[model samples]
Target: MENFDEQFSITKTVEFIQKNKSTRVILQLPPKLLQFSSKIEKHLKKALKNDKISFFILAGASTRHCCVDTVSSARVFGDLIVHYGHSCLSSTAQIPILNIFIPTKISIQNIISAFETEFSTQKTKQMILFYSTEVENSISGLYLQLNKTFPNLKRTLLNLPKNEKEKVKKFEQKQEQEQEQEQEQEQEQEQEKEQEQEKEQEKEKAKEEEKEQEKEKEKEKEKEKEKEKENLKIFGRVLPITDITQLSKNQLIWLGSSTNPTLFSLALTFGAENFLVLDPEKEYLEFEKMERMQPMRRILMKRYALIEKAKKSENIGIVVGTTNPKKDLQIVKYLQLLIKNSKKKSQVISMGVVKSLKLGNFVHDLDLFVVIGCNESLILDQSDYYRPVLVPDELDLALNHDREWDGTINLNFYPNHDMIANLEKKLKQSFDLILIEQQNQKQIENLIISRSETRSFKGLETRLGENKVTKIEEGLSGRASQYQDEIDLN
Candidate 1:
């Protein structure tokens, strides 16, 4: 609630409604900030007391700004959507979106001390102030004092341009989602039949299967709910930028931590030599830049190696990672078209979250799989599947032979018109060469599989259907402190 700017938000929302002649609006806040919806609505109603403006709160919580509530806005027929807390994505929505940036708890004194402590000894002039939602509170003070001392200090504000699309893809995606849900229900019903014991108790057996399927569905829903939770604990603290961008800017000092969506976007988008750590919590400011992001840099190498393997691939599977109605379907379509042009067989699979076990079933049919989703969530840990799972960016690099290695992966492929258009053109061009390559590669597929090690899951013969006892390293002592206050001797 500390980050909620009630006065400012209410005023702005009222003004916007009046100017646009809007009667209804939907409020979309991050899960962390959702509790303040009632208070915000109250203030809004009081302000527009005379007018009959209806305000609806979006029940579906979002993790990142990329998860725009297109469904709510469209379904409600809302004139505008007031998105709060997170920084904006470079996405054009069907409805007008008002992004309200609320400042974190970091004070001006803390920010000033961070700057002074970092540059007390040395003369560091070329420094950039990178900030997100925490702008209104800390920025004015930093600017007031710093500008007087230094002449040219640059600030990179991560604000998105307002570009509303004429056609909204929400309705179309919703239809596809409904059809998929129906298909899933049918498949689950079929699986229940195999799991049942006898036909004598058919109705009872069907009920049991329904209960089992419901339990599985409940688990999946819980997993998705956990995924949407924001790490609100990471906010307000300043953190170092680990990326090495090609931007000519000298030093980058980001104001927000990794929790802020803009921090990652700017770090990946901009090119700087070294990022100075000027966190408010630290007593001494880190003047020296941290070590280069070697792990991330290695992703480039992985991309190159994967591309080589994909070149000799005979079949491809397109895996859509997200079940959300607002996910991009164009990327899947384009990948299918690309593989088709190469004369390779391709299949599209909608897997909510890519699991190695689920994908292993298609290992024989598919030689390679391309995952379409968020860059962070696209690739899974260890990647234990038989076929290589690559994101859209990785797949794009692997398939297209005519593009320079930029060494940057866009998390959300938006607002990059040039890249998207060129990729389409390259994929649609004459495919005689690619088709020939695939034909030749088909001969080597069997040889590659024969050399690969087959993976297996085995049950312990001694303890079948038994719960194995877990080793407690600390035992009672560790748990005592955890529940000391709750336990009473009486």
Candidate 2:
């Protein structure tokens, strides 16, 4: 009755147990911690070594059935209750109750090292440490002493209440918030950097546009100067004739045909002793030898060689004929490959008949011929008592058609005389030439351009490469038309 609760304090409890020589110490513990309980019991017993202090190790079924009344009964029977590894719930006896919070297991050394690393690197100004009572008692004092040594580092030791589940939940919530805030800040910085890059790109684009505008203006001025120079030369020169040697050596003209004797003679007149006939057709090759003098034949053995030859030629031009338009076009293309290979120096001239000179029912004379050399040839096609003049107007009109569209006429099969005549008239009007040499310069240009566009064949033998042109049977029944259609679509 005289302040019995005062003795329940940890100091008094220890003192009272020591005084009683025959005190029965009952050690009650959780089943999970039975091993810890036995170790603690052995340690305590050794500390109070007098055999007068009786020890009863309650375990198994006895430990499972333990309650406050059972514990109180032990106290009434002159025993002191010492609960191990469990929080104290209630005490009914006036005898002292010692709640010894001995750890179930020791904290691993690795876990201590991990804690130290985490605490040192944490961005937060303050951090807290939490542990069970046993762990606190073992390490809290050491941690406090260390904190004093590093005064900048502060720590809070969470000495939780009997039930500390809620405190743990709150600590977890705070840690999650800190991590989320750090992540958001990092994301914001990345977005800002991306926006800055986009702004720099826009500035670069604006500068490029300004530079492009300046370049375009300079190109226009140069083009106008060239056009004026060309007009002045035309005014100074004599009229174009069958032979153009009278013109300046540097002056260039597009002769449209390799099959004409006049064109061949014109080449000789212009000091062109060498002939580079691009005629691939057997018929045109023979016709050139018979009609004109035996001129040197220039054949493209490989697409690459053609480029080199065209580049080296002094007066380069394309010569096309309407007699066999398709074959003529092939030659035109060969010349084009030469010109394109020659780089940009070679000029092209296309020549064709202005009208078909029909000789009765079976024979027709090819009045058109393109002479692409250094000069224009003087010879003209004769019909009985009249010599027909080759008109530039006709040539211009044909060239316009060739330039505008694929003038792929099969003159071997589908020679439309009226269409040819119309083309000639249009060219005559356009160029203001009364008797213009009929030529399709654009067709020859296209040939060169097409061959130039072809990719260079790698590791191919020279002779085999020359036959790169896809051949089809000479009739409409062949699949050449379909192949051409496919090419056009592409």
Candidate 3:
């Protein structure tokens, strides 16, 4: 109950501990491995035989690399931290951290045999292999062997495509171009010269040149579109999006697990049928396609609805919740510029941690709140709080026409200099999907709360928000005069 059944390099951990000679170290692990922290603590203590050196286990809720415990470790005066259960991010931590992911050992020969048997029947035109960094070693040989044996398989990473504003701008440009083409045609039709025969010959030559030029322009536009469809850039290593064109419409792309919620969200956004999961942890190599991506569609719908609400908001509050102020100052300035551009009143607010009770204190002063999260995304469960709390990217979705939500519903607002101009980020999974799962967990009591129950759509009644496909809850729709539909709401 207190030790992990999984095998890892115990000697390496011992070497790290010995080399550091850490007097006070913290071990942070995901929930499943949290129970085993105590056993790990004892083992480390016994191996070093240094009673003076202490090992403390973190007791905070940590799910992924995004929500790192560096701040938590610092608060506890931890000298070092040993993180477990996920691949380490390239971003440096505030303190030294040793990432010990859950390692699964399987033979390359056995894995390929399973792969040949299970994956041979797939009618996929092309194959690409991706491995999560944590278990890269477990499946790396397979990747190489597949390359040598199959030779046709490609190695690639996913690139996230363009945002909404880019599409809109292109559309406007095309419209202007078409208008110019019509004007040119009208000008060509006019005959100013009295030499009718020579004018006709000259006009025909000009028309032929115009047609050739138009054909060339069309070809150039097509080439540009193809390039755009292939090039997509993504942030950090987690769930970077890919241009769907570079990916085959008829191919089966396989991803190795260390797959978590972020990958799940990405799989849905990228088109589930186009991708498959190759989990080496499973006894047999079974690649399966994700069938459900509707949750992402729902999240997109809710976020866009929120974007509409933010556009009309008069009293806006910016919640600054980052641990690093120096790096985040620009984001604050950016928010101020955006708010100024929108011509709305704004007040900056900060609480060490954002909670409903704290946010409720400003209910009278603010109509909408934008939370500034640098590393960890702040997702306020509005199960109790009524006012909408949005992150910076959602604000861009509302006020800035140049910036658009790429359906990357991620709440974390780390201002990468490159992404500053284009806020192209997505969620690990829809917050609604998370809430839906939470509601499902409470079903033993026969109570199931819908994800749509938390958000109020009063602000979404405008034409901009009218693309909504989901229905409003019956209670909120003024179905009954007394609002008798209310029975233990939330």
> What lDDT would each prediction earn against the true structure?
0.60, 0.39, 0.61
The estimated TM-scores of all candidates read 0.56, 0.23, 0.56
lDDT digits (tens) for residues 1-490 of candidate 3: 2234235445556666655555788788777777877777767766678878777777763333434465677766886677676542423455555667666566677656766766577524356555554554455566778666565566544221122223344455667778966865665578445456765676798789879977986997899787656545232232222544555543544455524554553453455555666666677666566544235456556767888999999989988765556745778877876676566888998654667788899999899989875333445246777689888878877887777666555444445566444322212234457788988777844533454566576354557865758877544544564455567455
Pick the winner on TM-score between candidates 2 and 3.
3
Q: Which candidate comes out best when scored by lDDT?
A: 3
For candidate 2, the per-residue lDDT at 165 reads: 32
**Tens-digit lDDT track of model 1 for 73-110:** 77778887777765444334656666676655555666
Which parts of model 2 have CA positions greater than 4 angstroms off? 1-16, 19-22, 32-51, 60-79, 88-94, 104-113, 119-124, 145-490
Candidate 2, backbone clash total: 34
| Model 1, CA-based lDDT | 0.60
Candidate 1 clashes between residue pairs 3 or more apart in a chain or in different chains = 245-271, 246-271, 247-271
**Lowest lDDT block of 10, candidate 3:** 158-167
Ranking of all candidate structures by their lDDT, best first: 3, 1, 2
lDDT comparing candidate 3 with the true structure = 0.61
Better of 1 and 2 by lDDT: 1
Q: Could you give me the TM-score of model 1 versus the true structure?
A: 0.56
Compared with the true structure, what per-residue lDDT tens digits does model 2 show for residues 241-270? 223233342222211234433334334333
Model 2: how far residue 412 lies from native, Å: 99
Count of backbone collisions in candidate 3:
10
